[model samples]
Target: MNTRTVDARGLEPPEPFERAMEAIADLAPGGEFILLLDRMPQPLLRMLDRDGYRHDARFREDGAVEIRIGRP
Candidate 1:
């Protein structure tokens, strides 16, 4: 499976999350989206979950976050 990684180290957390959703909506019909962020908020994560996007998300102690969006 091909995955696209959006490095959100410099951008604002919300922007990266929005962009990741757009990317998933655009590309995930055929493949998947692998979102990588330095840090993000919990509410946004809950929003993603409530939106019914099939994902595996986690925040590391080092402040890195990984969110994988696959078929719903």
Candidate 2:
């Protein structure tokens, strides 16, 4: 299936982070989501990992980051 991508550039860091978590929580067992963010807190990343979402995140040249999550 095509992955769902959420661009969080307009949201406040934590707000987007919270929204991402909410979206993940609402997904079915075999869901996939990708999030493009602009500087978020580390705690949020940790929380996401602990919840079983696989992620690939890094700082971008445009001051944004991308995180990918795929359920197994």
Best by TM-score: 2
Candidate 1 lDDT, 6-53, residue by residue in tens:
776668657876787688668645466777787654675687688776
Question: Can you write out model 2's per-residue Cα lDDT over 1-72, one digit (the tens) per residue?
Answer: 878888877886577877787778766777878788777557767876787666678777888887777665
Worst-scoring 10-residue span by lDDT in model 1: 24-33
Deviating ranges (above 4 Å) for candidate 2: none
Separate clash counts for every candidate: 0, 0
Candidate 1 whole-model C-alpha lDDT, 0 to 1: 0.72
lDDT of 2: 0.75
Report the alpha-carbon TM-score of model 2 versus the true structure.
Answer: 0.74
What do the candidate models score in CA lDDT, each in turn? Answer: 0.72, 0.75
